[model samples]
Target: MIDKVVEVVSPERALRREAARRTLRVLNSGYGNHGASRTKKSLIGWNHKGGSPDDDITDNLEVLRQRSRDLYMGGPLATGALKTLRTNVVGYGLRVKPQIDADFLGMSDEEADEWERHVEREFQLWAEDCDAGRMLDFYEMQALVFLSMLMSGDVFCTMPMIERPGNPYALKIAVIEADRVCNPPGVTSPNIRGGIEVDQFGAPIAYYIAQKHPLDSKSMQNKWARVPVFGERTGRRNVLHLMEFERPGQRRGVPILAPVIESLKQLTRYSEAELMAAVVSGMFTVFITSKTPETPLGEAVPLEQQVDVTDENSYELGNGAIIALGEGEDVKEVNPARPNTAFDSFVMSMTRQIGAALEIPYEVLVKHFTASYSASRAALLEAWKMFRMRRSWLISKFCKPIYNEFLYEAVARGRINAPGFFDDPIIRAAYSNAEWYGPSQGQIDPLKEVNAAKIRVQEGFSTRAREATELTGSDFEMIVRQRTKEEKMMREGGLLTNASENQEVLGVPGVENEE
Candidate 1:
């Protein structure tokens, strides 16, 4: 029995190893990998197959992005999904809640508090009007970036006003439309790779920004030039190319709607088909003739002139129009009794697929909450997680870098004071340390969720400031300050009880009575 078992297992193991060997061979060839390959096959250096899973995926990205943008801008499901993302993830705007962490710099308590407050105010003012001419603030600029990121694969933000005349901060970020990113004009140098100039390590050294969108009607869209990653005059990072990377060495972002473009197209077709079906189902076809069924004399005139209906003067069945048939052989209504039998079910299924690709819930997409409360809540929570993750990414990638640059400018211009601002990297980091917060995803059941968060804080598992930040995207210190100020004003204005009354009723002078 033991010998027989060995005989069966030995061949199986050999076969498995052989299959793995072939896979490794293909991977090594496709990945352009050399020494990583081994005589004994291994999965460690394996590369993905089909459509060249490589660093040079810019061609695929561009093609998919154009099609994806068309569908998103026009297709119903795509439009709804995008709208849902913007409403839920961005909502009003991702407000900048900067907290200059002087505490991390080991400053005195009083000094830290004052410095943080002062810097916060400075940052806020700067954030209010980021444009050179103040057309849109940083908040509004964020919406454009995210929307373009969804529609196009990536977006570019060039500091065109880094040294503009009359610019206060010596910095101004202009949101370049995503359509402008393209191959550099005229020079086919190998260094210029995939709509961007790159270093030997595949890092983007510069970008080619076009004068006009390729699809724009006014121009043929063939003019572009290489814009440096940093300024020629100052070497400061003048151009910031924002893109979400998936595979290693990818230079540009793949549109978020890329995965579901086909689905959106099909959904649009389905909607049109159902609409046509309903139109066909609405009217009756009338067969008109003379009482004796007047036969065609001989040579047939045009088919339209052959049929002599009394009310042939365009029976346009619209709003209040009615069709009156002549004394005919018969008047038969050819209305389809069943209109779009599979419409509801099909739309639900396809939209669910689309929602999954868009990282939104089907219920959210259609605004249908027929499902159980628990199920609906679960779907919402899952979608909210994706939104929260994306928001964090946005803040980290774009907001943090921009804020750091703004801080440097602020320090340079004597707007904010830092004891060791230009000295040690640690102090510089502490000075630059700030949190960028957006809108929070408030819980479905606020009472229950708030209670849980309260418990978490009381148990020392979390901090009140962190909890407050998560709930409202505002610092707890700032919140408390505002609350204290409001309470003082209200008490002074005779709208609230004194501290004694608050303590007697709520057991805490700082606590407020609920209305």
Candidate 2:
């Protein structure tokens, strides 16, 4: 036999190999720490592969964009998160109420009242027909389209029927499905632009909206073309692109569900497995053994001798049914897989993370309130911060601009009275000034909250108008007018309000007990 010799590498190569191996070892260690604090986010083993908070999102936006939107529509947790957010964000509908800047308009109280009435009348008339076609009114349209933005990451609105017959102000908004904004006809990609064309400043210069949805199977789908952001012959006011921009330079929106996609998939799988296991646990399997010495125990029985479950007797195995076994045959109940004790804890844990990912508290996301009052209220307060912020963004991006445009068309057509409407910017500002009120989060303890509000108002820390609007989603001025009418009517009927009666009871102790 030949002597075996171990080949030795050069010293330099040995050191290089050792360094490479050490690098890999460090990487596979499941910790990206360089002697950092254990509590530091990046050093956490679970978050090792995740990019840091400072990581630039512009580079990978396009990659995660479509898939995130798809999962938001089809994935359960994704859909729930979107629906939950949308409900809180715009469910009550941001009701538009004209609030003319009195100082800017230099109008007296009586003139301002008239101006408000005229503005409200014109606004209601236009809003009734502002939605695309005659199908949905403005509020319904807002909710539907807002849901799309939450689901698809972006939505397109076109003013195609601006000058529709019988419609005043020539203001109409038609919703275009997000998928239509794609590559130009017969082109895969030239400049890596996904329907949006941006200028050198990274500002949106034009939008390429296809006539048909990109995934539509119709034969005429190929005929759809991309339209410019501002049509040269038509005009720019015709198109509206709404997207939730996450990064400074990012062009398109990534779905709100992006962070929870993987978790949703795993949760779905776990739920399905549990359901299957539950079904199988109720089932029983048959085992047959021969009692005679001629046939060995556990020996396979001949086909002809084996018992068969005919269709007529199959019902015996069904719920609440009893069955008789063949001679020497025994029934062995199938032991169902033990339901994982950690299942609920695991699902709740996953949902908590999902809620965090969506910036919604778990209680709000699930609409569950089994927690203590303080905890529940705290969760709501925290959740409302995110919701209110999103509402502000929605107002700024979609509502406020749309209203201004509506005002422009209304004023141009003389639908609303506006002296010097076109002459001065201040007049326009006063005319366009408005507030959108949504549903109020009513107090759980009404009297306590009401007393607190009254105290705050008296102390000049709050205003009745702001508090009323926040509590009722109503116009404070309109409320006072209605209350005055009710009081007059009640006085004529010889009835008095509880507030007046309470004045008589002042300084009296236990009047009810005396009575």
Candidate 3:
């Protein structure tokens, strides 16, 4: 028991020791217990850093855009995603219907209706000839903008008033691709992010647009123009930037394929590999065995004279050919077992995950709806929800703004009348309000869908207008008018005798049989 010495620890060392112990204990508990545990083999090398949305997007924007375009061009799934969106979201492009506010303009219902019709006609006249290049109409331009945004992450349009021959409206829309908008060389500022200059509150102030696309000519790439957000005198939007924001401060749009890029690429590679394997496996060759070269392998029989032999050791396989083997060489049978038995299941599993990421259901993405009726209908309904959301976004980001500008120009030129549109913001918004229609969600079972729609309308759960629009993408009033005209025509032609008879022929409800 003689000379035991007690060592004293300093307060700083004691505190440090205690803190380390506590940190380890915390790491071994709760979500961090496994997820944040560095001691585990799985998560030992897992490391991630956090950054603002702009930092994450702008830092890798170029690579992201190029890769997305490549995948769209090369990958079938990527192509399907793009085409599906275009077909559902902007099929034949969105047709605009003016919804002017009657109360605000102090006009009766009839007056408002008449005014809206006039506005629509005038708008169409300008819209048909709105393209600056005169190549595409406004509707086709909508498809271009939608596709550009999906492919390039963002698109820019300059609404410059140009007096072109044979075009009544001076407003011409010139579509610009994403590469045209960029940070000018040797111009760096705290306010600029990806050529979009924003104010302190993160609102866009202006954009720097190059005269020519970067890929077009290197010499013209440096020629840039600083276009302000609005006209100086009129305060109208001069540039329309179509992008969907993921984060508040994000100035640039991420491509639609950004989130699923890696998955799509890997899937494409896997598909190509599988396809190559299947093709290779389909050769069905039968190799001959020989014990001695002198024994002589059977002569390479030509199926016809069309077969060309390039190698002595190899011969072309025929429909039903017998071959003899040389002595002392045994045939070693090989089976690649390609066209992998698990290929379809594995691909579908991966596709489901990718479709989920892209907000597309597996059935819709692959156009495979072999499931039960309920299941197929559910998938369609889910896909329609996403399509509708994207359609709404298109309306807000691209369609409405351009239409508002066109309407303003039309009003200024005395083509359409809008009272107090310029003086009050509310009135201006009302006059600019519109309903955009696109292709409808097609039916699987028309009879069932029609009956359900009928019941919904009769029960007051939905309106005929809403049902008609949802089922057929047709105006309810227009349908009603057309049906009335057809019935009158049929009556005049003796195809219809009475209302009950007509109802019986058409299978319409609310018809009583005459005794």
Clashes of each: 0, 0, 8
lDDT of 2 by residue, 1-515 (tens): 11111115355666676688776754632343445435545566644354422234433544455667666656667777877777877886788888888777778888888888887788777778876667887777778778877766678887754666766667777887666776576565433366676677866666777766666676464554555667686343556777787657665656566677677877877888887887776566444444653433343334444356443222223444354544575645567665767788888888898898888888888778888878888898898888888888888877887888788777777777777767887888888888888877645567766787788888999998888866666777888788768656765676654554433433233443121
Reference-based TM-score of each model: 0.77, 0.78, 0.85
Worst 10 residues of 1 by lDDT: 295-304
Clashes in model 1: which pairs?
Answer: none
lDDT of each: 0.72, 0.69, 0.85
- Stretches off by above 4 angstroms in model 1 are 1-56, 101-106, 132-134, 162-167, 220-222, 231-235, 279-315, 318-331, 489-501, 504-515
Assess the local accuracy of residue 247 in candidate 1 as a C-alpha lDDT between 0 and 100: 81
Which candidate, 1 or 3, has the higher lDDT? 3
Candidate number achieving the greatest lDDT relative to the actual structure: 3
The 10 consecutive residues of candidate 2 with the worst lDDT sum are 1-10
lDDT of 3 by residue, 371-469 (tens): 999999999999999999999999998888888888888888888888787888998998888888888897889999999999998899999888988
- On the 0 to 100 scale, the lDDT of residue 390 in model 2 is 86
As for TM-score, the candidate ahead, 1 or 3, is 3
Q: What is candidate 3's TM-score against the reference?
A: 0.85
